[model samples]
Target: MSTKELINNIDSFVSTDVWSPLDPYKDEKIIFQKGDGAYIWDINGKRYVDFINGKGSILLGHNDSDINQLLIESISNKSSTVTGPHQYIVALSEIILRDLKRDHYKIAYFSTGTEAVKASVNMVRMASKKSIILSSGYHGWDPLWYHDNGPHELNKNDILDVFFVPDLLKRAITNNKGNIAAFVISPDYVYLSEKTYNELFSICREHEIYIICDDVKQGYRYRSGNSLEMVGERADLYVFAKGLSNGNRLSCVVGPEQVMEFSRDFTYTSYYELLPYISALGTLKKMRNQNGYMQIRNIGATFLNNLREILKNSPIDMNVNGNGNLFQFVFPNDEIEEKFYRLCLLNGLLFFNGDNQCPNLAITNEVYDFVLKVITQVIEQLSSNYNTGSFSINDERRFISAWRQMDGASDFIDTSDRLIIINKLFSE
Candidate 1:
């Protein structure tokens, strides 16, 4: 179906406050019909490699046979929720506690990452008896952290103290003093030096402020010896989602007894749901039995190292950042990024301009080799056309002919400011 007709029969074309629809190649939207392993087929049956992986949720890949089998069993057995506790939930909680090596921490269930984050903040507030929460990194869609995204201007929630920058965190802590509740953080995408990490932790500890480690996106991927691990010391509370059920809709907040007891008074979805619990249990088992987390970590490391090698001698002024499991390229200009995406899409590859490349277990050596080949071709083509004065970004044939003199003029454009910004944001 046409994009217009598809949206016309469903929802309006207007973008929501929190999310704008992704712009496919040539501004045309695509609706995917099916997926298997690391590939997805569009409605027209055209296949493309899927590196997005459902925003990093499907670590095991699309339509994973093992997970699907479990799901089917649950459905056929008529296993469902009844608004009461389930024995499987207790088992799932135990699995999380054991895997995280947090024997003293309690787990509270939620249906989504945002809900878990909100719950984590509330828990810190209740335990600390403080109103302000110092935060860094994106913490999901809710009035608490994300109001809007306008680069120079983002609408922050007015109800709470949620600071975006590290400097602002220090200032807020000073302004609030003892009124600071927690210092929430996500370390997956954001690059903070060891000095910054230590400084932030020390400041929080000095003021007796609670620490909430938002691990929704990085939990399972950073596991060591069957336990989830991060770069720094453990926090008082940890919010987990996304990688837990490998795309299943389940999230959680885990913390110590004193802080988690507040969950009794907090209204949340009951943990009696059977399907998500089954998914969680099965996913955790797969990870543990196959040592899937470690495997994934190794896979990511391999990809990153290989990517660095591939781009090392290239003329493209780009740098990769983020942890081994999640990384992105820092480009010099949005137009360059847009062109890169278009090129990859036309060549049976998918590339999003969001600056994150999340790999899944489906990224085998063969799959990665194909990806590298495509990337090499894209980069080579770009480099060849850089100073040739033969390429035109515009699609209008008449305009392109008229503006032939402008070709390669873009090469003279200075992008020093953009490079400076990238370095400032990611080099720390």
Candidate 2:
């Protein structure tokens, strides 16, 4: 069938797909036909360089040869989901632990990121015996701590509602002063992080709070280990996904053995076992190949440097944010950013941020070059538009005020909407 037919026949995979929502990220509406190394073709046969990477899951690209072969072998064995230990799973788990360099990186398999997340949350909360879960919205959706403080931004995903970071979670953790459950955080700054992680970890440690780092988005493509590598092996719980199976349905939460033991008491689950093996084998093999890490990091560095060159040459104000395989290119004004998003779409690039404020993980040398070139063209065209004059700090502040009212921040908030405030001063 054509890409259109594929979209028409989509399973939607929402309520039935492990905590997935009906139309999360609004991507369900887009028709995708086939995916190659770093590009996906729509039913219309219009190939677009994919930056989403299944939301950064497919680090090695869609349908990688190695992963696909393992998948076929695993599927043929009819051992997709089993009750007992399997060589594939054990190998995977062992490889995963070994790769993370946590001699005690004891892992329990989960079918999806959400399950991994839920399991991690329960483990930490139980171990810590606290209820506060501090984190950005990237962690799988589950009941650990309430994201009710409201400053977090809500986006409609094709499968579920996503509460993203823009709000400060630590403020609440500090203010509440109750025994906190787990402090979950993304290593990257995309979610309300101003490199406050060092202090945040220190505070959580001081309070005896379990510091849970969600390395889902930045798992493999960027660093040697997930950004959690910097945190040392001491975190009470750390969850990893994406790049594990080269993008297959695999995720694991590694924590102190005692903390992970908390999962023994509660047995809620949704994931299949095959994915664990797939993730383990794929990640292990890739890492052992040795050059994978430097290849991705170098590719990413090249891509970033090119972006900086583009921004320097462009008349528009733009900057790249975050780092390594998971960075986002930020434009000066939301309108231009939004316009560039559409423009990128027109140029056959699938940018994630519809608002143009954030475009992440272009992936691969060719795709990255294509995306940078397109961005260069867009900036050149928009730069000459006097009406598109670079936005200033004051202008950004005004935009934030208006955006807050428009986004319903006037009504409620969870942590301080500091991202909104901080983003305002970050101009072109």
lDDT of each: 0.67, 0.58
Off by over 4 Å in 2: 1-29, 77-81, 103-105, 143-146, 149-175, 189-195, 231-234, 265-272, 354-364, 384-386, 393-428
TM-score against truth, every candidate: 0.82, 0.76
Error of 2 at 141 (Å): 3.7
Best by lDDT: 1
Question: How do the residues 220-328 of candidate 1 rate in per-residue lDDT, one tens digit apiece?
Answer: 7657322123435667788888888878888999889999999986644555777778887888788778877667768667777888887777777555555456766
lDDT of 2 by residue, 1-428 (tens): 65545554555533354312213324434666688777788767788777666766666666666767877887797867655555675666665566567655577766677778777877776676765555543455454333333333222211111123322444555565775576666455333333345555676677777767777765665565566555343466677877677666677788768787776643334344565567557755765575666676677778788788767766666666544545655555567766766667778777666211212222567767777788787777777764545474343443343332122122123334534553433331
Evaluated against the true structure, the overall lDDT of model 1 is 0.67
